[model samples]
Target: MRSLKILLLSSAFNGLTQRAWLDLRQAGHDPSVVLFTDEITVCRQVEASGADLVICPFLKDRVPEQLWNHPQRPVVIIHPGIVGDRGASALDWAITRQVNRWGVTALQAVEEMDAGPIWSTCEFYMPADVRKSELYNGPVSDAAIVCIRDVVEKFATGFVPVPLDYTQPGVIGRLQPNMTQADRTFSWFDCAAFIKRSIDAADGQPGVLASLLGGQYYLYDAHLDSRQGTPGETLAVQDDAVLVAAGDHSLWIGSLKRKAQAGQETFKLPARHVLAEQLAGVPVLDSSIAQQRFNALAYQPIRYRETDHVGELTFEFYNGAMSTEQCQRLVAALRWAKARDTQVLLIKGGRGSFSNGVHLNVIQAAKVPGLEAWANIQAIDDVCQELLTARQLVISGLTGSAGAGGVMLALAADIVLAREGIVLNPHYKTMGLYGSEYWTYSLPRAAGSEVAHKLTEECLPISAVQAMEYAMVQDIGPRCPHTFDLWLSQQAQSALTNPQYRDARARKAMLDIQQIERCREHELAQMQLDMVQNRQQFAEKCRNFVFKRKTCQTPQRLIAPWALTYEAGMPESRMLNG
Candidate 1:
């Protein structure tokens, strides 16, 4: 690839530009970034970047003509909009119009604002049902990366730019300026289309301002219903869903925020509830509402400490929904447990979900930094393996849904105890990633190769009873009668006091055999990599098979014996607390 000089004009406040610059550098281009802000803060940032810093008068219209015509290399301006759409608030306009498809484009900078010739564009489709906040944070941000990657790839290949045809139908659109207060006020007489569009356009960044009986509220997520009722009249209330009347139709206001004396308080209401009856007469709340809002936003992190036991340690794998900070905490806890002499380690999740797997947010956030996210995953894997290899028993108490990485965490346990309603699912294939956390070996051992293969390939949710019947779980204990804490206490006591357990352990020499089996399993995992591309592909194949069988009536297929025996030498039952 031929190296070329590149100048990146961006906002100091924009994270997208920083990410684009990193991508360009990784692609072997000599890229320099300049913040397009009049503030001194932006100047300092540009200077710190060790790039040529030039101060321009206006962000939209004042690109230095000389720099744009630079002879040494091309000057490309990254516009956070799709081809044919230009100017500020382009995204906001698209959202207001409920446009299903939008994108970001990198174009050659020119004298006119947003009038540059497009170099490359990356397009993405927004879900029709998505809220405005979701559209901005999810698809819009992702589209930026997509566009940047395309631009960099084109640059690397010595590709020539094609000029866009302005005369082509549906190929030109002007920009809209930032929204004003008047633009956001909600009108009760507006049509369903207008109301829905208004709600979508107002999203979180520029929220909708609605006058209630006496105070103001911001509508976040809402739907339009044609059912007629008196405007602003309450209909009914269902958990977390609210229905209110518009002029000609009823509007389902799923979530909302009220402007408080201090700030805003997002209150989730029940569906079909009468908004006028419940909140119309009430005066705007002051300090009490503010306290409630604060309390609502505060969330406590789950923390588990290892107790003094040879075989017992606590194992907790983050569900894919976890944030980077949460994953960091989990890794730290695992390291602490590994260093200790816990005999039987119990793996559990606090909520209804054992784990969803690795946090996709972290992955998306790390795209700008390239492989840094994978490095974090590797760290998590190391911590997980430490638990798997511990001399003590590794027990998994799966009380609810365990999907993707969550399933791998349960598989890592020597014994898995699942509640009656617990579900085991592998969901990686649909999202275009592999299953990590050593599930490739751990799964086959727990349920046999046929079941493991089917679980991954079919991507079906296996019930707790089915799991136990298939040997995925050691036992399906008492149904709905006992809570997880109660079950754990009973199991721990049984392991600590049962003389039969001790006697059998001494006679069978299980520990030595378990150590040998774990080694063989690790070796098998190494060998599987030669057959499969990565842990993700192996996981994806397994998930595809499972999803394919979701509607089948036959008993779920299992993995072959060779695959099961490949890791069967590993111990299934060991007393962790003893």
Candidate 2:
């Protein structure tokens, strides 16, 4: 293949976009990104970018007629649907309608949205129990990458795309209307399965709206329960999640966004916290003794299990945001897991995200936002300390994208293995904080001090492969979740007898505690100024993120120059626009 000059124009540099950018670069092609700000600006950027082709991996904004019709270059749109599928809610409809098969299509940009002729299409069996966000980041993203690679190859070969034909076989998809709030509305009287599907379809965005505790709230992070209870009643509360009865069975809800009242900002929080007053008398189920107690809830966000010589610890927080209490609980879990007889400890994250650092929503919702923010960061630091000073060989398995302090927390482990196609944003400059997770010690040790400085200052998102090159990760695992699990197990079991593991464990034991503590102290001092003093407007950033405010203009850092230089090759930050 030739090294084509490609431009990635996206609404935001999200996970899929970052993956596309990395794949293109790894394939020896020059790729740059231009964030979609407005119609005029997008057109201007596209015209100015000297590229042979342009791809919109996750664009929400429509391409302008001028750029789409330009004869000098070709513009392709990566749609999350199969042939003949047209609409913004393609995946949402697939989940809610319980479609068995779904696909991703790469089509030429035209006047009509998602109605262009298809260049390449790839399909997969739709997963039933997965959340909408997980589906997008997983199967949908995998298929889109396939379509994208195919489109790029076909473009290089001067191949023409097939037009949409209703009579053609496998063309089962059709135009789906944009999913509205009404489409996602579910009553407590609805069956558990129906309610779970409704809520799953709308996860990560506008959640399913329902009445709870005599108030209206948007529900998210749904999980089915086996126990039955009276419809519309709160059954129990555990791990900040509330188990409630539905029409047929019961389900667990992890988070809720209360309906905004006059002059109030609506943001998602732990379900129990949202209804703290209303559910004050509700029983809090003890997960440690759930099996012993009849009718006990079995919800566990942080789970630990042993397999032979490996102790696997999985922490799947909602949207990868760890609240203060959650962090404290995880610290205890880590201590317990470290005491196991296993030779290697594997720390795994959720499918949707590994960890995105402190819970901004929880902090913003607190009575004293700054103090809460301080506490949250401090709590997360303890998690890092546990990993850094672990007695056994520790391996951090990143199955999803991570950012900010989350990346630092992963680095605290002896060996970091990331799933292929995952992105890691290892800087905190975008969030306007110096950041602390003992990053000052771990980052420099993993990656050299010079690269660490460059990464922090540049605020660029690196792909898993790039992370490996910078020594941020020891290896890259498979993209598929099941396959990665197998690979993680094999690797963990092999690490017990590997000389590298023994050497790494010895190095960890010999690490100077005094120096690590000093680094944490210095980092926390800077963090205190950033969080407690609010010197860099972290509160404003948090509010903007929680409110989903759109950026009017692309930051100078994200805008690719007309002349691509070697220094400007890295992918831009995706969370900056958040």
Best-matching candidate per lDDT? 2
Q: lDDT by residue for model 2 over 1-578, one digit each (tens)?
A: 98887888898878898888878878888678888888766765666556788999988888988878877587999999888899999888989988888899999998888777789999999975888999999999999999888988998999877777888887888888999998888777889999999999999888988888788999999988887888899999988899999998999999999988999879899998899988888888765421322221345687777789888888889888989999998998888888878878999896679999999999989999889999999999999999988887899999889999899999999988899889999999888799999999999998889999999998878989889999888778888888998898788888767774565566677788999999999999999999999989888888788787877766666545543352244234311211
lDDT of 1: 0.53
Clashing pairs in 2: none
User: What Cα-based lDDT does every candidate model obtain?
Assistant: 0.53, 0.85
The TM-score between candidate 1 and the true structure equals: 0.42
How far is 251's C-alpha from truth in model 2 (Å)?
A: 0.7
Which segments of candidate 2 are over 4 A away from where they belong?
A: 261-264, 288-298, 500-503, 563-578
lDDT, candidate 2, residue 385?
96
Where is model 1 poorest over a 10-residue stretch in terms of lDDT?
Answer: 551-560
Q: Name model 1 segments beyond 4 Å from true.
A: 2-75, 124-126, 156-165, 168-170, 177-186, 191-193, 224-228, 235-242, 252-578
